[model samples]
Target: MAEAGLRFGIQLPVQSQSTIYCEHWETEAGPAELAQAAQAADRLGYAYVACCDHVAIPRRLAGAMGATWYDPVSTLGWLAALTTRTRLLSHVAVAPLRHPLLSAKQYATLDLLSGGRLLLGVGAGHVPEEFEALGVDFHRRGAILDETVQALATALTDEYPEHPGPRFPFSGLAVSPRPVQRPRPPIWVGGSSPAAVRRAARLGEGWLSQGDRVGDLSAQLRLIADVREQSGRSGPFAVNAIPPALYVGEPGWDTGRHALTGKPERLAEALSAYGALGVTHLQLRPRSRSLAEYLEQLEAVATDVLPLVRS
Candidate 1:
């Protein structure tokens, strides 16, 4: 929970340019712009900065996905040095793409170096060609991911962790510079598929749901609750939601019909409904054509919007 209202984060622009959500300015932006955005998020009190992961974008998806994915570990680790307080998240790293030890080492170093501000959000992944390119079985990725999650749970926390699994087994190998967080960073499983929800309830600290329609969230929440209850998970768990593009203040021009546009007060009232549904965190992606406009939106949220809505 944030000091004021619900905790919020942004999938920082200029990192990943997925056709579905990539912004206009990102195509031309670089580290200078990314750092500026991250630093502003930290200074303005955003909860965390998140980045997406993809080893490669196959030619088929290249047109829509622009083939520009900054490695999450490297991006977040870089931002970790630039900002002091904001948390770091991988949004949804495809864990089945790499061995758990490699992932653990990279993330453990990041967490330890950054004073334990890493939240490892992972997914089973969907890109078949990328899996093929990496020599991982696309059909078995889900099972592979399940095992990897168990392997990470051990590797991230123990100095000499042992994981005897179907693949990637180890008994005596020790990893240096363990994560600063005692049990390692919190893992928020991504995706809203049946397997994803179940994996989150059974293994993760939270669920970063994949854009379940607003009308359907109640059913999904109930399902999560049922699974947690069945799995004996009595501890706290975060349920996340990502709303469509938002234009905080009235744009007079044409912000789309789905865009949430209004005075700060109106936005607050509308957003408060999310809290009623038990959403612990909300990831906001403001509509912007330039870095300056984006930063202005962040400032507006920090000064005007957060106060009225944060609980």
Candidate 2:
């Protein structure tokens, strides 16, 4: 049940968090672990189960972040199969990586399989190496993402769907199994750029602000507002901010800017401040010393951090 005036969401970091974690466990959450995480999140009343979509993180983050990349759609389909209530979402699937028509079909299939639980988050991918791996032109990916969104919007419609898009082209093919969500499954545009803001306003239900500065977010919000107003849209749009890496010990915490890094009460205050600014969702990546530490942090977040935000 949704709170009277609040909604909370938790994003799962599906990427490999370990250097030696087996490759087979990369995609599926090992069956038992997936079940446990899903059951736990569902039991705790989290609204959505979100995941990141990356073919691979840049070489620089090989040590800092994990290497194994999981397919979010397939993983979400599995999550949906296991969990009943939690809506399945991808933080941002790289749009230029797949055929828009194919993605539409796949998501529609997933939506049907999940009983209409899908929030399709799309983005113009940033990694040039991944694009190279896929044989896609990295230079043209932004344009491809733009046109991909348009093609998707058109394909998800009921009426005559025809798009002579530069990235995707379809004449009169009936793209079957349209998304269960009316007017399409709540497309949220990701990335923090003027172009991204414009793309979100022009073709999205909201903006997915990932790994950005507070000043950058404020400016982007302003740009979103201007674009939305120009396009005759109104208030109550969402902005889900992914705060900076929050560690347990940081000196002189102000609690005004970045999300808190210390106690639950402090983190709660930071969440509340974002909420006060009309931020509907706060997605945090827990700092972990080990797998044990990750689970400990997740437990604390589920028990202590989430409740304060909920309140």
Candidate 3:
């Protein structure tokens, strides 16, 4: 849990990327391995464990890219069972893959089972081919995502939710077992676009920034803050940023671009810079090839890095 007025979290790259920025880290993380990693994170006092949500594997970037992705809902359901404290999240579930009612039901069960420990992060997806493969119109996803957000929120509340929208309609239906979080879960809107900022101000709990671009992150967050203020919402809405990797001590790890690469003093300085910029949460991850390397990175972060900056 956060302080009385603020909340913070970390993101785990649970999809197990084969290569990031064309450099190989861990090529594969099996189901058991993922579960163990989640357990380890819980033991380390992390607040959130987030997984990338994808319906189909994108092709040919790496030879090992096609390995089975552990489904976020199923994986989180198990993670909730395995860990008593850590919250589970889909970093950015593609909104067009599943119907809003079904998505609401799935997350509600997970939230209930996890004792309301669910942060529902959603995104208007990229990857045109993935949408084509999923049999959804790639162009109209923005409208669809808007409807999805509203419908999910409604379905999580009223037993017989009814909506006649441009995208879809739901009437005379009961989506059972409302989420453990009253009204709905904390729906985080991700992306750096203007639309994303407006959406977050209008309907989301926070704006989750992605990728390695810090200048972009700063500007987007400023826009979110400004928009929220224009809308007359109070301050202290979450501004979350995920650094690319926490690979401290790795050769050629750019400390300039990412906050989590460097010795304790340097990392602390970088993190303080984010804090100065009004970042309430900084989500860090370690880039490594094996379990030993991963744990080593985590240990370095816990021992050398965390104490330097954690509030």
* Per-residue accuracy of model 3 over 1-311 as CA lDDT, tens digit each: 11132233455544545344222434444666677777877887777888777677667533555444557888789889999888887878887778998998899999999999998889888878789888888898877888898888888877789988766698998888878887778888877778877887666777777663665666776677677778777634666776556666754644335435657777666766666666766676776656677777776776677777765
Please, what is the TM-score per model?
Answer: 0.96, 0.82, 0.87
TM-score, candidate number 1: 0.96
lDDT (tens digit, per residue) of candidate 1 on 1-311: 21123787888999999877877789999999999999999998888999999999899899988899999999999999999999998989999999999999999999998999998999999999999999999999889988998899899878899998989999888987889998778888998888888888788888898877667778778888888888887767887888766777877766567778878888777667777787888887777778998899888877887688875
Candidate 3 clashes between residue pairs 3 or more apart in a chain or in different chains = none
Top-TM-score candidate index: 1
- Alpha-carbon local distance difference test for all models: 0.86, 0.71, 0.72
C-alpha RMSD by candidate, in order: 1.9, 4.9, 3.3
In the range 4-99, model 2's lDDT, one tens digit per residue, is 344666666444344432223334455566556666667667777777788867787676556666688888888888888888878889988998
Candidate 1: stretches off by over 4 Å? 1-5
Which regions of candidate 3 fall more than 4 Å away from where they truly are? 1-10, 21-25, 58-68, 232-236, 249-260
By lDDT, the candidates rank as 1, 3, 2
lDDT of 1 at 228: 84
Q: How many Å off is the CA of 155 in candidate 3?
A: 1.4
Clashing pairs in 1: 4-310, 5-310, 5-311
